[model samples]
Target: MIKILIVDDDIGICKILQDFFEFKGYETCIASKGKEALDLAKKEKPHLVFLDIGLPDISGMEVLREIKKSDPTVKVIMITAYDEEERIKEAEKNGASDYVVKPFSLEYLNEITLRKVYKQLFEDLRTEHQELTNTYGQIVFTLARTLEEKDPYTKGHSERVSQYSLDIANELGLSENEKTIVSHAALLHNIGNMSLDDDILNKKHEFTNEEKEVVKKHCIVGYEILQILDNFQEHALIIRHHHERIDGNGYPDNKKGEEIPFLSRILTIADAYDAMTSKRPYREKISSPIEAVNELIKNKGIQFEPELVNAFINVLAKKQIIIKENIQ
Candidate 1:
């Protein structure tokens, strides 16, 4: 049986969840305060967590963070009052597996707990991945073209990155919004690369300190270009920070982990994977598909959202999407 932990400040809510989930064949653990909830969760190690946003001892987000930190595999569903859209989004961003608006019917709750939450999470992850891609695509073409005139040797690099981005985005079952932003980000990830001297771009040799510095600035350059466009404002962070290192060693600004927006992180996985797998102007080696995915998984949380890395894996396993060459 599935083990579920219900954490709500209200005794009534705890009773409600216990009865409902137990009736559905789940073993249930109940806690009426956030502190107790955290203690119970640490002890019980439930398969799923149903958490209320309002708690007596600590805020729900605080509890959620602690729970995930304790055991990153447990899926947490935030239970919030109907008017808490801001809280809900915060929960989503803060590693929440799903959220349920309060005053929901027990039957609906049961169904969501058993079936709907994972689907929602998968869809949302995919959507964000796509949106980031599309946002990057809008700016990279010009940068790639600029580089092409001077380097000639790396004519299709950005375009190929765009293609690889699309493939991975679809493989992840990314939502329409995610595919859109990321496609654009992939295309423009090299905006800074365009400004490097032709000798450096087409050098076919290890980059000098100065050349590498010039190449690393594309992330910031892309961010600057898109930061001003209408609707582009939404994806500016992604463009500016995609190249950031997981260990805070990557170029431009060294923002690490969650400090980097999800869009930028998503693009980093797609861009880095493509760069490793596809032939590049200066590098010609290609990793096997399995090898590429393993590399992405190895970098999760440090460089990508752990959930996204898992979802990307599942999407590939399920093969649940189709990709068309043209975005129209």
Candidate 2:
């Protein structure tokens, strides 16, 4: 039987979704919080997810990343209260298959769930969703590349961040599951950048307070962006918390210290290293590896994790993978 996982904070909604999906001859599971949903997604491995865009603990976007990382093929359809602009843009950028707004008709949503997930559920000879996971992921990846290419400073930034995060993950002795989750997070962590204007992104002048707020919004934007993606739940923390600092000075949420997910903290290190080592549209690059490492260390316990900072320093020293402001 096809299985559907419903992640939502409203107890009433959870019960409604559960009863509805069960009536449709499908097995269903429910979790009221984002973290619980993630845990259930792993244990249940549901074929599809009816995910809400908001949650009590973490936002639905973070949960979406985690879900997608665990199983790329998991069909996810976002259920939101209304079509909020940033959230919608974020969902599309993060590769959501489709969405349904709240106060929705159960009959209509049921039809949608079946039409999209039936192929993944059945081995029908005429099924079109037989390879839905891999197929949809490629299409999203192409879109992700396109989004990044719009900004030279960030072109291939996702790829490099993924690589660096993978390297750090290996050194930290992460479990296979954790490593995969981290890798996926690195690739799509900046998907929220799609909501940002090019003019704001490439400005040579310093940002006004308003512009700075916009810049700081990318993390939350990313969190909202991936809320509808089937496979992006586990990775959402990485995207949302990567900008968070050890001292709790980061944007969107000022999550402090270990309050941030470990993967996100690790990703932050990788992201900063890459940004420092690359050229931006407005600023000259910092081209010295030793200086970059020093800068990271100098700010540790403030901007970075002390242990992760030390571990990364060792990696750079041993591999001569010095952090600089420019590459090539």
Candidate 3:
């Protein structure tokens, strides 16, 4: 679980924040004084801190300096009643992740906290890399689940696609590094849909041409969002082009066979299969796993890479494949 430290002299404020953060599924520690905050921060090594600008024992700004000096990576978000520009600048200069003024909205604080958690996860990924991929993998999947929750029909799609993609990667004898990248791409493939309109995303009917065009833009949006982060730069391209087809009939960019990235070609099959077998709002009945594989073989060299289709089928033939019940 992501840990948080809350530092405020007011007992009511501390209790309220503790309740809210705990309800949000975060592990939280609270300190009423700046000196106590430093001691807790050093002992617990919390990933993030919400530091009050004024504290009973010591100045919060001074405590912030000490915390950063002790652990530069620990992110601090200043909480202040004063909104003076100078204090804000000083906080920024001292490396505060963000700030919230007194009497702020609980919703705003929730948003800020979630954003910082993801940022902290990314930082951990950079420092630990492969050793911590499993831990970070769950974090990323949780983000993907947040997207899936917006549309009921797609609840487990990301996990299924991720597993299928990983199996395909193994079939191709990919390196551990390459497989990990593929898994991340698979997990986040549809994250761009988060920016889409809910009506179109969960419509019980086919999309009109304009709505379809809007839907296609998610690839570009997801790519833009992921490419900004250094850790996901390489996987960004695969996510952007996962919908591209080999026959030059795909969207965003009309890249044909060999023109499309290889990993993306592999992802295409995995993504399509899960979507085929999973229930969607527009389609009441999902195709069975066997039927979905047949569709893949039928569409070989057109919607997917012919060689990969054959490989995926061969791999599945050797294993007993059982898809979860389709969500209604």
Q: What is the C-alpha RMSD of each candidate to the true structure, in Å?
A: 20.2, 19.6, 16.1
Q: Tens-digit lDDT track for model 2 on 99-179?
A: 888888998886765676566545532344436645766765676788888777778889988988888888888898988
lDDT of candidate model 3 versus the reference: 0.85
Worst 10 residues of 1 by lDDT: 319-328
Query: Cα RMSD (Å) between model 2 and the true structure?
Result: 19.6
Measured against the true structure, the TM-scores of the candidates, in listed sequence, are: 0.48, 0.58, 0.57
lDDT of 1 by residue, 271-296 (tens): 67666666656677567556777777
What ranges in model 1 sit over 4 Å off? 1-156, 163-175, 315-328
Candidate 2, poorest ten consecutive residues by summed lDDT: 121-130
Considering every candidate listed, which one attains the maximal lDDT? 3
Model 2 C-alpha lDDT versus the unseen true structure: 0.80
Global CA lDDT computed for model 1: 0.74
Clash totals for all models, in order?
A: 38, 20, 0
Stretches of candidate 3 exceeding 4 Å from the true structure:
1-142, 322-328
lDDT of every predicted structure (CA atoms)? 0.74, 0.80, 0.85
